[model samples]
Target: MKNILVLCTGNSCRSQMAHGYLNTFSQGKAKIYSAGIETHGLNPGAVSIMKEDHIDISNHTSNHVDEYENIDFDYIITVCDHANENCPYIPSKNAVRLHHNFFDPSKVVGSDSEIHNAFLKARNEIRSYFQAFVNEKL
Candidate 1:
């Protein structure tokens, strides 16, 4: 099985969403994990959006990249530009680093419905990108 790690700044939104979709779509072919430069608990908005897709990520906790220091991953994908820039060096000769930036929906300051919609858009986009990447690249 391929061990894949998705990374971002807060691990609250994009990375978390990516982790869920990848794991769900990949079935058991990929062991997926997500983390950040700094740990922030999973966003409730993210959980809600994921639940809409019938994926429960509410139990998933935010993690720091340091937690996976002992484990080697086949792929380390940065899901945002901030994470790509701030990512710490992992001592793995064979690890493939890839950058696939996604817009941060958490930055959207609006009404409750608008905020939720932003997350939904982000979730859909992430799913699309993940599908393309898996089918065409991986």
Candidate 2:
């Protein structure tokens, strides 16, 4: 099975979403993992949005990238532009690096409804992008 890693600034939102989507899409064909430069715990908004699709990420623990330093991955995907630029170099030269920038839903500041709507939008965009990625790239 191919091992893939999704990364973001914090293991709170975008990376967690991507990890859930990839695991769903792969159907055990791939082993998926997610980490961040810093661990801030999972975002409730992201968990709620994912639950709409029947994907539960609420049990996933936020992890630091340092924990996987010894593990090699087939692909390392950065889910935000900032993480893409600042991501650490992997020791494996065969590991493919990809940048798939997603807007930070956690930054959306508004009423409860507006924030929820933003999460939904972000989730939809992530699904679309990941669907195309798995179909055409992976």
Candidate 3:
């Protein structure tokens, strides 16, 4: 099975959403992990959005990348520009790296519907991207 790591500035939003979608898409074909340079805890907005799509990420933790140094990952994906720019060197020698700056819905300030739509947009984009990743890579 492929071991995948998704990284971000905070393992709170985009990275978390990507992790959830990748896990659901992989369907046990891959071991998906997500972390950040710093843990800001899981974003409730992210969780709520994933839950709407039936992928529960509420149980996922906000972890620091240092905690995963021991594992040999097959892929390391940075889900935001901040993470892609600041990602530390992980010793997973064979890991393929990928990056996509998914929009942060949590940063949107608007009405409830607009906020929900922002999360939905991010969630859909994440779902689409990971679905392609699994199809082509996993």
Candidate 4:
């Protein structure tokens, strides 16, 4: 099975969503993990948004990239520009690196409906991207 790592500035939102979608899409064909340049705990918005799509990430923890240094990953995907630009080097001999700057829904400051929409938008985009990733690469 392929081991995949999704990276983000904070493992709170976007990467968490991607991890959930990829896990669903891969269907035990691949192992999915997510971490951040810095841990910010799981975002409640992310958990709630994913629950809408029937993916639970509430039990997921915000991990630092350094925690998985010993595991050999097949793919390293950065879901935000900050992580792509600033992520620490992981010693993987054959990991393929990919990047996509997903919008940060946690940064949205507005009404409840607007905030929910933002999270929904990010979740959908992540779902679409990882669906393609699994179809083509997993």
Q: Output the number of the lDDT-best candidate.
A: 4
Error of 4 at 23 (Å): 0.9
RMSD of 2: 1.0
Each candidate's lDDT (Cα)? 0.90, 0.89, 0.93, 0.95
On TM-score, the leading prediction is 4
Per-model TM against the reference: 0.95, 0.95, 0.97, 0.99
lDDT of 4 by residue, 1-138 (tens): 999999999899999999999989999999889999999999999999999999999999999999999989999999999999999999988999999999999999999999999999999999999999999997
Residue 135 in model 2: lDDT: 80
List, residue by residue over 1-138, the lDDT tens digit for candidate 3. 999999999899999998998888898999989999999998988989888888888999999999999999999999989989999999998999999899989899999999999999998998899999999997
Q: Which residue runs of candidate 4 sit more than 4 Å off their true CA positions? A: none
What ranking emerges by lDDT with the best candidate at the front?
A: 4, 3, 1, 2
Error of 1 at 35 (Å): 0.4
Pairs that collide in candidate 3 are: none
Superposed by TM-score, candidate 4 places the C-alpha of residue 56 at a distance from the truth, in angstroms, of: 0.7
How far residue 77's Cα lies from its native spot in candidate 4, in Å, is 0.1
On a 0 to 1 TM-score scale, where does candidate 2 land against the true structure? 0.95
Clashing pairs in model 4, backbone N/Cα/C closer than 3 A: none
